[model samples]
Target: RASLPSGFRHLPGHFDRPAQEALVAELRQVITEAPLFTPVMPRTGKPFSVRMSNCGPLGWVSDLRGYRYQPLHPVTGRPWPAMPAVLTALWTELAPDAPPPEACLINFYTGDARMGLHQDRDEDTFDAPVVSVSLGDSALFRIGGQKRNDPTLSVRLASGDVALLGGAARLAFHGIDRLYPGTSTLLRDGGRINLTLRRVTRAA
Candidate 1:
């Protein structure tokens, strides 16, 4: 893999096949408790192609009003499922210096779904790195400098891969350009699941 921007770490095959499978099983249970729901653009009210859910103490949500992190599910009005131990363990291993993660946003992307390049600025603090785990189908992950128009580069992120955006790349613009379906059998059906762990608030 080519050199990525500073503070950007990509660990390909970070989780072995068995580990990925176990994580998938855990996520299935998470979905049962926190059903996936479609998020909409704040003003246009157009739904995002990817469906979303969350775990941990807080969840990231976007709707007609705007994007923000809250303690409960927008649709269920109940607190999100607790973050899986596997995920919290990963955070402890990878981001030991940062505060424990409080939000794990789960994004489910089907074929033809794509996310435009954007910055993750909803959090109140940028001190902790944004840790992401990729599963199932491979994706073309595009990343660039903090500015939206900065020269961008794309990388193929396969299942079990883990990416960390911190320091200089913490506020970088990034997104999934497209998916290479059938690349991995992690998911029964062909699709991709992205688990993004973020520290939503500043540590005391």
Candidate 2:
């Protein structure tokens, strides 16, 4: 595989179409159990364009109270659905040195929906890397350095592609600029789904 900057690993077409479909089907069940909820911006209360849910023990949420991880769904008040073994296995294969992930954030995106550049810093430990899998459609993913003004790299993350943020790149700023509709057949609808595996607690 070609090398990227330190701590940044991009594996194109990491999962085949069949695997993507299988994962999507599994996520369907997760959505049924946990359901998707709109995450709000802290203080502003502005809702994000994407709807999200989680698998594993802790889930990330944002509302008037603020952005934080909780044991239960903000609305349903139930624990998050267990993460599928496919995801857990992927994480173990990709980040063997890190502890098992406790959270798998699922993001559903549609046309015109985009995530602004931000750092994933809420987790307690930096020892573990974040493993993100892209399914359905394609997204223009942006990556910048730790500083806000640093140079950035734009990569098209298509269905089945995976990216890992570890080491110095773990705290790098990143986000999805936009989605290219009709780019992939993984999702019957012209939208995208992103699965991110994270370790919320400090490594023991």
Candidate 3:
């Protein structure tokens, strides 16, 4: 169990083999029930690199205007699916200091798909840490300081790996550079699935 910096932590093989398989199955079911789609970027009106959807009380959405969380899916026009107990438990154990997460952003990435460096600033509360779990292929995670050109560190994240970003590093700029094809045996296709859990705001 290699720990991350004070504010960060990396749990290698965090989710056991069986647990990973079960999570994949649950995600597949959720996709079948809600489906995944590419969302447009704010202002530019361009589509995001990663195709994403959500399964929880709230879903993160981006549009020509900006990024925001909504109670309903823009495409399905229905409330997002409830968060799975497994995910909630993971969050509660990993980020006890953070508020209960209400949004689960599910991102599907192909070999070529890459996420640009950005901060998780849409949420109203910064008190909670962001919990990101990776499944399937391995990816190079580039993490940097709050500034754009600040020093950066790259870490290889594989299936069943969980990374936590919190405290001073909570607002760090991070992104995925690339995914190693056919690295993990869990995924049906040669790709990666990333689930990011966040506390959007204080409960009403």
Candidate 4:
């Protein structure tokens, strides 16, 4: 287990093969129901680099108008798939300081896909941490401070890896530089799937 700079926690290969396989199966079923789609950037209307969808009570959405959380899939107009129990358990274990995540954003990254540096600030609550699980191929995760241009650090996230960004680093600017193709033999073919759990709404 490697402790990331900027106080982020990197639990490498935390999930065993059985657990990873189970999570993948759950994700496949969720995708079959909800499907993955490219979200557009707010204002620009340009599609996001990474194809994404979600499960849980709410899902993250971005468009020409702006970014926000919605209860339904934009394409299907149906409620997003329910968050798998394994994910909920993992979140509880990894981020005990945070409340139960209200949204789980599943991002599908092909060999060429990449995410730009950005902070996750859509959630109303900042007291919780963000739990991210990586499956399939490896990816270069760039972690920086709260400021956009602060010095950053890079880490190779592999299958079954979990990264916890919480406490002071909860709002740190981070993104995926690029994915290392063909790293994991577990993926259906070859791709990276990242599940990020966050509390998008306040509990009433």
| Candidate RMSDs in order | 1.3, 2.0, 2.4, 2.1
After superposition of all CA atoms, the RMSD between model 3 and the true structure is 2.4
Clashes of each: 0, 0, 1, 1
In model 4, state the lDDT of residue 187: 88
Local error of candidate 1 at 202, Å? 0.7
Write down the lDDT that model 2 would get.
0.91
Instruction: Give me candidate 1's TM-score against the actual structure.
Output: 0.98
Error of 2 at 126 (Å): 1.1
Itemize residue pairs with steric clashes in candidate 2.
Answer: none
- TM-score of each model, paired residue for residue: 0.98, 0.97, 0.95, 0.95
- TM-score: model 4 vs. ground truth: 0.95
Name the regions of candidate 2 deviating beyond 4 angstroms: 1-4
- Consecutive 10-residue window with the lowest summed lDDT within model 2: 1-10
Tens digits of per-residue lDDT for model 2 on 88-152? 99999999877899999999999989999999988888889999999999999988888877788
Displacement of residue 98 (Cα, Å) in model 1 is 0.6
Model 3 segments more than 4 A misplaced: 1-5
Alpha-carbon runs more than 4 Å astray in model 4: 1-7
Model 1 lDDT per residue over 1-204, tens place: 255689999999999999999999999999999999999999999999999999999999999999999999999999999999999999999999999999999999999899989999999999999999999999999999988888888989999999999998999999999999999988998899999999999998
Candidate 4: Cα lDDT at 124: 90
